[model samples]
Target: MHPCLEQADILELIFKEIYYRPTGSHTEKDLLALALTCQRFKEPALDTLWDTQLTFGPLIKTLGISDAEKESENDAFDRDVRVILTNDSYEPSPEALRRFSSYARRIRRISHVPDARSSILEEMNTELAVLVKLSSWVRSETPGPMFPNLQHLGFIGTLSWTSIPCLIILLESKITTFSMYWGNLDPKESEVLIGLLGRLGLSIEFLELTPLSYIRTPIDPNKPSIFSEMPFPITLSWIIPLLKELRSLSCGSISLNQLALQNLASRCTFYKLQSANTSDDLLEAISDPTADILSPFATLQHLELFEDNFRDFIKLVDYMQPLALQTLILHHTAPPTASTLADLLHSFSEGQHIASLRQFSIKHTVSEFETINSVNMDIVFDGLTLSPLLSFPNLLIVEIDTPCGFDLRDADIRAMAKAWPQLRRLQLGSKIGWGLPPSVTLVGISELLIHCPRLEDFVVPFGARTDPPPITNSTPIKKNMTYLYVGNGRAPGDGSEQMALARFLKHVFPDLCGVGGEWMYEYGLEEEQLDWAAVISLIKTQC
Candidate 1:
């Protein structure tokens, strides 16, 4: 290749890397600037700039089509074959309208018809008419052959359920991923849209619905109660039918009534279900009578049930009779009981022929302080029958987010070590409070590190109150421990506490890879001194 071309190629590659960085990375702005330095850089940079997903109002403003012309044709088309109009709200500006109109004229899909009378302004108006005409054309178009390569189509702002029917009629055959947020469609209307989706011949692999909120009271408190009480409509229940074809489905605050879930299970072989707020009513809806609610997930690989009713979780486990479940996630909630927790584990072992379960995460809600403090350390560590099951011998990760005060004994840790020989990651939450003895904190952690020999990552809140006895080298630690996270809290021995902890780590495990912690403001160490670099370096080594 010529040297000039090679130089251009290098610049293009650099530009692509910078453009793809996560939104807030420090290098993003600088990279964008470098890409605009010359013509070769300009083309790729502009391509990246236009690669953005476009919204409807912005398109209208960008194209500069007049409202009169838009009203006349009712069809809008774009020359960029890859471009898709997102129905998100965008306030249009005059310049945007002209740009879009100019781009629209080059596309073959928009046909121009001449009238006997010709005027420049009228010709511009006619061009606008063509754009609007395209929009209407899309509405009436049948589903057989439009947009064959389209992967995603998102609806942004409020749109009536009826409008969605048009969408279904147009692109249903080609689109595989669909997402909608905060639309005006009521539950009944939403159901209609879902039903329409079920009839589409194409397979939709992913579906996401934004949370819907209805106003119960007007802001004017003094106005005569204008809001007449109508029997609140039954919760919207439309998506059940379409669930059958979905590989993935996510919704906000879904009410899993029995019928809805049964419908979902019968029709859809869903591999994943993510929900924000799940009620017992909904849990009861989907649970199998004889198995854990999770049991029916024969094909399910990933499940995220965030901070739901604990009872529902129990019911879920009861229904989730052993299947091929691999990953289980429980966020912002405490385990209901040792028995319940055991049952969940047992279900995974007995119900499913799982070769290896990858992750088990439980993040306790902040309010569960007492529960965390009161956790029966023995049951969690030693009392439970986890060892005999030996079901998750290949388990890779376990995470628990809870308040401080719960204490784990050395024997309990040893039991876990015996059960999960190949465990790789463990994340636990710790809060410092007045009630617990300092010795209890240090010993529990020391015991855990000593037990899990293959463990690689350990995250715990740091800075527990200073007690007379500091963590010593009595217990042996696993040499492979590589990542450590210490949360912010009070630490003993001033700034030296961190160094002391590091010393303890080095002494107990000479192969110590990383050290980092959250120290209380009172500790007087600047935030910059938190040893994050050391921690990162350690993690890199382990990886």
Candidate 2:
């Protein structure tokens, strides 16, 4: 046991690379091996080894099985290795206790993913009981708060909604970052959830609460219903004031009622606020002139409006004057006209809010099937010079869509390029509705390449000219141009013209990488379509 290896800092630095390596396969294997090298390495290496665990199986293995004991194989969390741990439980031996104490005490994060099998309830219960018991045993004096070193904890969605109360109490005030993705929380869990929010509200710096899954996922009827007892709305008032330390918060389908929105607006402080659907109230409440303004969320740096109810957009935009707002995302609903998009960009043009914005996206909601073929955006690109938007001199990403149709031509694109020459990621145009694609040809695209040298990722409507350009060595290498996902499908699928256009693009932007939509390859006079590979092939060959 050398003094050099005794340093936890050095060992942790050495072990972290293996522990957090990208590939999932036992990243901790080397750390475990290091733990065996010497007693000094044993403590630090074991600490790094058990810090994050996929299953408690590794910890359960530390408690040796007795002759009479047999672990249940009912639920196979990891089918590769089956030991459900419910069969015949045994008390921890002195040697096992010493070993468990050595490692378990060093745990900082626990990712408890219960089996998704039919017996998930039983499996989660069994696992929770073990954690409750083990933590109690490890910290003898305390009945709960098992791992004093634990600061981050996560629970899988497979558990029954009934077990949330117990889970919350088990966490107590020790953990500062918590994530629970339980899909649906019944009325009973809501009561526990409210209390849990209160108890840990002050301590939590980062929180993720997922009580509901995506809008498309069908509800499990056999499971307890979320609406059974008129589910309690989770108001921000319950959290915001208390959680002065809160920096990041994410809630899925949890209602942020008016009272909560008021508190947030009035207090007007936080780093990030992201939630789905609840912004209906937050937007309305924050927009209210009489809502006790510190300019209602002026301190908000990042705001993601995935609101299901996007009724008053004009009003929403009126109140979106965040002093430090950097990234803004609006999901679902009618696409904003170029004029409306200009205003949002204009918000950054003036005030102390100047020049800090980097990414702004407005994606039509995915859940709305009715809008699949409906007209959402019909814009006259000539009217939307959006020159004021160019005031954002350091802009990095801009996606203002016209899902219905946009009358964008070559001159309009050249004007756009003149406005924003620093954009790295640009996603314009739309694919959902029935309309003629915006009239942007290779000439306009050529201007974009010539102007924005740093352009890397792009998704825009593209069309080839009736008379294509003659290739020459004058084309500057748009080497930074990489990914392309065309919103509008192929413009001219005609064999020679389209092929020539592809060849021209690959020539000009010698490193031009990909084209989106249905891909087809030229076969003599005709072309055979192979949507995926064919389009990618167009972007590779150097001019």
Candidate achieving the largest TM-score: 2
Q: Write the per-residue lDDT of candidate 2 for residues 308-365, one digit (tens) a residue.
A: 3444543454566546667876765545555555664554466444467777766665
Instruction: Give the Å error, residue 12, model 1.
Output: 10
**Candidate 2 TM-score over all chains jointly:** 0.69
Q: Candidate 2's error at 331, in angstroms?
A: 2.9
Best by lDDT: 2
Q: lDDT score of model 1? A: 0.47
**lDDT (Cα, tens digit) per residue for candidate 1, span 13-38:** 76777778787764745865675566
Q: What is the C-alpha lDDT of each candidate?
A: 0.47, 0.57
Backbone Cα, N, C clashes tallied per candidate? 48, 2
